[model samples]
Target: TKIKNEFPVFKNKVDGKKLIYFDNACTVLKPKSVIEAMNNYYQNLGVCSGDRSSHLLSWRVQELVEQAREKVREFINASSTKEIIWTKNTTEGINLIASSFPFKKPRDEVVLTLLEHHSNLLPFYEQGKRRGFKIRIIVPNKDGSLDLNLFKKIITDKTALVAVTHLSNVTGLIYPIKKIISLAHQKGAKVLVDDAQYIATHREDVQKNQMDFMVFSGHKIGGPTGIGVLYGRESLLNNLFSYNVGGGTVQSVKIHGNNIKVQYLPPPAGFEAGIQDYAGIIGLKAAVNFLEKQNQEEIADYIEKLSHYAFEQLKKIPEIKFLADYQNQIPATLISFYFSDKKVSLYDFNLFLNHELKDYFVAVRCGHHCAQPLHQFFNTSISMRASFFIYNSTKEIDILIQALKDFFNRKK
Candidate 1:
């Protein structure tokens, strides 16, 4: 309850009841500090930030931007700020890497898993089509868990990269990324982890994991949308071909008698080609600072407990068939489940939770949750997801259970 008050969104009533935000996987509610930080940027310094300007506002903006970069670096325990590239979202970062990565065509291969989101899969799939690189897929086990032996068999010296999700959005299963990174390294393949879901409830140490590339969205955390991060090793980032080119990318461009010469800036600036989202960056910094102050370890433990509680509670409902691994510890903060009753559709259940359920709105995600392949693995078309965060509580879970019981009773 104390932590819940930090988010101003809870103050507002939805359909005559308090809002129960269970869609943390899609996007978490922003805290007051993050919102204030963003508003501060617009209100105080609404100017462009780059080398071209020397004015006071521009200098302040530049300082904030760099400070935010440093905060992110510290948050992830990155080696330096040069390794961080600001992007619009995780999708953009994946696309950037897919386009810019040095793929050696027919001989080279990229290893991916069935658990990847469309953002992680499509970029590499499309790139393979253009680059003629072989794409290998690792299928998960029957219960939505990965098999390391299969992964070992799939990854070989020909594999240039192993792109996989740190956590499954559909099943809410946290993959062992550190081990995955080790395996990829053994096979002389770089690893790119889609940390969109994992980073929300866990502390990410890119250095410890030795991750070559990592991508996530600010909105998945407590920051604003339209701002994300792509963390890559400095050397690898410098080697990558530029994804976007525009106003801020190049240091200089000279055109003399139709002979043009251009010198592009280094990694971060080169990758971030356009005028950046200053407010979003500032807001992300504030979000990181907020999380840091709260202590990520404690938050993680709390969320884990809440996840277990939710799992146990949801398991009581016989109709609920969970996609997650319920036999062991539930590492993920979310749970995805489906109904066996053909009469109860995913859409109607989500609708009841969001609007028609006893006047309160229990916000959840419906549909494939962007992991259609995983759904195919489970042999289902769609399911509903209820993801939790720091602000979520056991009381909310009880309410959700009661709501579910009410929903089922009404359906019957």
Candidate 2:
């Protein structure tokens, strides 16, 4: 309850009713501290950083940006700050890797899973198309759990990289990333984890996990948008080609009569091409600070409990069929379900709850959730998801349950 007060969005109401924000998987509500941090940057130190200017504001901005990078490195237990590369979001980070990674045609291969969000899947897919590297998609078990045996069989010496989501955005199931990393390592393959969902509630140690690379969005963890972190092994980052290179990426340029040669900076500087999102970086640092203050283990436990409660409550409704078995030991941060009646439109139901419902405004996501392959695997066109976070409670789940019951009963 006290934590809910920290989020300013809780103060607002929709149609004279309290907002039940169950779309946390899309983005979490920002706290006052994070907002203030961004404002402080704009109000005081709004200047170009990183060799652009030699003024007080620029110096301050540079200092704070590095501070944020260091904080992210520490947050993810990365080996060094050099491993952290700033991007617009997780998609850009993945795209950078896809573009820069050295994939040898006819010999190199990329492996991905069905649990991936579109961000993790598309870049590699497009890259594969261009590079002619073999691309393999690993299918998950019925419960959205990774079939490790399948992975072992699929990943061979030819596999260059194994990219997977640490947590499924649609299913909210946390995958066994460490095991996956170990398996991929055994096959001489590098592993990349999309930690966009996991980073918010779980503790991720890139060093401990031995993952080659990891990416997550700032806004998913109560930070500002347009800022994300891509963590890589320092050695690997230095070796890869910089995808988006410009002013900030290069250290020096030499001009031959007709050809120009450029010397690029190492790791982070080279990877971050343009002027960085100084305010977003500052807000992200504040968010990391906020997360540091909170008991993450407790928050995770709370979210799991709330998810289980929501699952049990939703299961009572005869019209609903859950995408994954929630009763399992695997903890969930969200629950997705489709109506038993195939004729009923998922979008209409979502619209009913989001707009037409008078008792409460429930913000649930309805669609493929950017995981079309996962939906195809499940043989469903679309499903409704109610995701939760630290600010959510059993009371909110109760409201959601009642709203769903009212919607279905009225339809009957």
| Model number with the top lDDT | 1
Q: Encode model 2's per-residue lDDT on 238-310: one tens digit a residue.
A: 8797699888888899999999999999988888887889999999999999988997788788898998898
Q: Candidate 1 at residue 88, lDDT?
A: 98
Residue 299 lDDT in candidate 2: 78
10 residues in a row with least lDDT, candidate 2: 323-332
Off by over 4 Å in 2: 105-107
Candidate 1 lDDT over residue span 305-346, tens digit each: 888898889889988888755565474688888997866887
Error of 1 at 261 (Å): 2.1
Off by over 4 Å in 1: 105-107, 329-331
Question: What lDDT does candidate 2 reach at residue 209?
Answer: 89
- On the 0 to 100 scale, the lDDT of residue 269 in model 2 is 89
Model 2 clashing residue pairs (backbone): none
